[model samples]
Target: MKKKVFCVLIYLQFCFIFPKTSFPGFRAWLSPYRMALGGSGYLSFSPLTNRNNPASLKSKKTFYSGLIRYPSSIMGQGLAITLPKKERVVGLAVQHLSYGTFDGYDSESISTEKYSSSDTWINFYSSKRSTWDDLKYGFAISWFKSSLAQNQINAIVFSLGLQLYLKSIDANLGISLNNHGKVFSNSSNSSGEMPKETVISSSKKLKYLPMKIFFDGIFNSRYKLDNINFGGEAKINNDLEFVWGTSLNKISQNTRQSFWKSFFAASGIGLAYNINSIKIFYSSFFLGTGTLYNGVSFEINVI
Candidate 1:
């Protein structure tokens, strides 16, 4: 157990100390559960969390999930399906983001036709337990595409992840390297780079309370810590749970506001309900600019 822990720590240190060039796209949160957790879900077991950590694909049953975000000009949706095969699990997911139509203008400011822009991702992933039952490892390959009017770009990304289950502490620790790959563009206006991130996360179920807590750190290039998020899920009943989360970046951005307002800025709250083999989730997020967006998603278990 100690050796496993050490290995995870070493890997995290290496990733942080040796940063790589990172671009600026493909970092959007694809899962409602993750967004509701203030962008922290690297240690979660839900199939929707597969984009954050492929090692979370360890499950005995198959799962299918769909998500939609709205109330904003920029809309997004995602779909994920996971299948268990013998001792390993394989999954596929797709996420799409659409920017509202924009009016086109020429160099002389003449009005032209309206155009829309969008980004899409398709991911294939797999995971399995290591020699030790407590350790899990996984990898993922993603194809990404972005379009803006007549310009288009494509990229392929690769990710690797590791998760360790500490039975004694009833906690899970995970590390992941995501979006590490090259990009190609059909237009000269596009940059041939994609964003990369390193994440460290932990989740623990309280022994004395019917709750679980999560903490996650995200790092970008130049060894800079991009964000730190904290989230909690409390069981309200056998079939329902309350979820809430906040991030340091949000709080920092609203320091001039009221204490509570600043604290809740960029925060999120939601509820999850379970009925038979289906689970439903609803979430609302408070943007730093005071705008609010709601998301809904559902998952079904297929034996």
Candidate 2:
């Protein structure tokens, strides 16, 4: 019954929160643009092997923070870093959620009160790939904050992913186990003592069925001296995707809107360029009222 409800909520969201022309709500609003454009992207997530499922993790340009995302009204930043390596590849990333401030609504009056304090939920994660065999693994631990009510929800997440690589065409099949929602706290009153010290608690914690499995593939080609990357993937159930991206291209603005605005408002093209050891690109997400995210990253040789 709960699963049925969750599905209906997502369907209803499409009608209101996410119209055919726009998507600007909650998690969708805060999501980084690059991944968003990649088909409600879970496969493009760094440190997690589930969605960031490019089979080219062994290439020369493999270990670099290929994305930096900043959303308007969002209090935190998301970082993706790839460690330098020749044989053994390591990837690390941290997504800081909530710089602070969330409004709590009073059930009686239905009035919202913004909390003066909030906790930072960060995903500390890493991945490893080497000449070991066909098995590629990745994992991470996450600290979470309140997903709903008055500081009543908080918990930790333990995640693991396994990738099975196919020899032909360089394709990959992967599965991941994740704890989607868990809450932990002390004092059922919503103002309890620390979780470790008290017997009574107000928070929630992870329980059951928090798992996801996905498959993805990527193809690289060169056109007119420029590089073209074609990639797509699907995550478990309830998510779908299809996208087109190219490098070394620009469009002329023939209107009053700014070049960037007009370029993106009309489903503009993205630019990805590699400079020596660093990879750079202009990525943005059109979610929310529309935010422009600017990002930069460098590959560091660390073991």
1-303 per-residue lDDT for model 2 (tens digits): 343344334334433432321111112222233432332223345442222332223323344343333332333344555553555444554544332344455768575765532233455455556476776666656665543234344567555555666666344455444433345653334532211100000111113422222222322111112112222222223322223222111122123356555444313123344454443444443322233444433343333
Instruction: Name model 1 segments beyond 4 Å from true.
Output: 1-25, 45-51, 58-63
Q: List the residue pairs that clash in candidate 1.
A: none
Among the numbered candidates, top lDDT falls to 1
Return the TM-score for each candidate structure.
0.86, 0.47
Q: How much lDDT does each candidate structure score?
A: 0.73, 0.37
Q: What's the C-alpha lDDT at position 176 in model 1? A: 89
Across 154-176, the per-residue lDDT of candidate 1 in tens digits comes to 87889899999999999999998
lDDT of 1 at 108: 100
Clash number by candidate, in order: 0, 14
Misplaced by over 4 Å in model 2 are 1-33, 39-45, 48-72, 80-92, 99-119, 126-132, 147-152, 186-269, 287-303
What C-alpha lDDT does candidate 2 achieve relative to the native structure? 0.37
